[model samples]
Target: MANNQNAELLDKARLLRHDIRDGSFTGYTSGLVPGLVQGNVVILPKVWAEDFLLYCYLNPVSCPLISMSKPGDAMVPALGADIDIRTDIPQYNVFKDGELVEQVTDIEQYWSDDMVSFVLGCSFSFEEALLRAGLSIRNIDLDRNVSMFETNIATAPSAKFFGNTVVTMRPFKPADAIRAIQITTRLPKAHGAPIHIGMPNKIGIEDLAKPEYGDSVPVNDDEIPVFWACGVTPQVAIRNAKPPLCITHVPGKMLVTDKLNDELAVL
Candidate 1:
């Protein structure tokens, strides 16, 4: 990280976070704030927060807990000094009784004194790592959100939080797939490595062209689809648990943080 480059990355992250907090930028955060970490937002009441924490512990690959806010607190000082969880996320999925009630850009109206915000590491951080390694990620190149789908693979259950895992797919040549695995394995907090590779049908995914979330990108005949455990997995579990009130970032719209992606990689 050169001094100039680091400064530029920090500037971009700051500007983007400001836009998000101000309710101006409300869209997919993929490819934005290139070298910084972006997280999946999940806000739950104190009564349900402990159970959700246990869920993250059980399904680390999909729900890797990064920075969690103190109960009844809206600020995550660990991720960023000025982050306000209530309004930092670009978009939120408001769920009631396991069903989505509405999608909103800001969650200030839903904020509660008992609410606890949990920030989970997202694949966007690792995508930048991949790009830096010279691997071509189709979704990023095409300016589209990574393709995500529900898998038959079930996540480890904890109390009321239990459901099948959800995964994001990126097509790659054999060599690139191998390199991606090597590179991503170091970032355990960012979902680690691909849960399944090559065979979508083997994992109960019926169609690649039609994904459950995000837009579909081309997967050439010679390319294999590489799947990574996604943060959205918890959203499904949250819905299953059907808490009285639940909120999560709409898929692809993340909460930008000041932490660098490289800082999260493990040897």
Candidate 2:
């Protein structure tokens, strides 16, 4: 099912996952595996999984589920046969009762038999698509983390998981922004389309220099900020819900999986 490019990309995923598992790769995973899908990781106990699943269903843009492992299972067979949720991701954010208590390179000690791991499609998938289409992503080009912010836009609530939407911003020239929009619209599984463009203040973002999550890069005057619903939206919901225990990928760090970007395209 993989082309030569995807095979090369998958090899990168394996190597990157190995590095992450071994505590060598702790930085944000951007532009690592060019074609393989990278995902936002969320882990929760079975008692809390249902509500989160409902939240994901109610808010597809913010929580696009690519694959979810069964309760008590660590391997995500759909994404990769050997994915060990406890260590494959570069970093994990541990939340306790709505607060981020710790961040670690691995969650082996934190893993429990009743835990369920959810892997949501990431913007990295469509970023690759954009790059192939000749669009330059500011974050990647500058080698900095993408800018993400919590917006005033509220996600449709499901159970106790309620919070405002989180968005990732990328700057582009107007014409290139239009083409980027058309390119990304084809990958619904990768958060489909841009939710806002041009003005950050309109979306409750007061400062472009300071992002709520990830590193903020310089935005050129000739370029406009384009925003997309981020997978971090679920993490924000988890924080609001204040579950007893929750684990998520550290903002920009993601789980590299074997799926191809085009494989997730809708049209």
TM-score of each candidate structure, all chains considered together: 0.98, 0.97
Candidate 2 lowest-lDDT run of ten: 1-10
Best by lDDT: 1
Question: What lDDT tens digits, residue by residue, belong to model 1 across residues 53-134?
Answer: 9999988899999988887788888988888888888889999988999999888888878898899999999999999999
Error of 1 at 240 (Å): 0.7
Tell me the number of clashing residue pairs for each predicted model. 0, 0
Superposed Cα deviation of residue 7, candidate 1 (Å): 2.4
Predicted candidate 2 versus true structure: per-residue lDDT over 1-267, tens digit per residue:
536666777788888889998998899888888888889989999999998999999988888998988888999889898789999988899999989999999998989889999999889889988998888998999899999999999999988899999999999999999998999899888898999998888989999889999989888989999999999998889989999999999988999988778789986
Candidate 2 lDDT score at position 225 = 93
Model 1 TM-score, 2 decimals: 0.98
Off by over 4 Å in 1: none
lDDT of 1: 0.91
lDDT of each: 0.91, 0.90
How well does candidate 2 match the true structure, expressed as C-alpha RMSD? 1.3
Which pairs in model 1 have colliding backbones? none
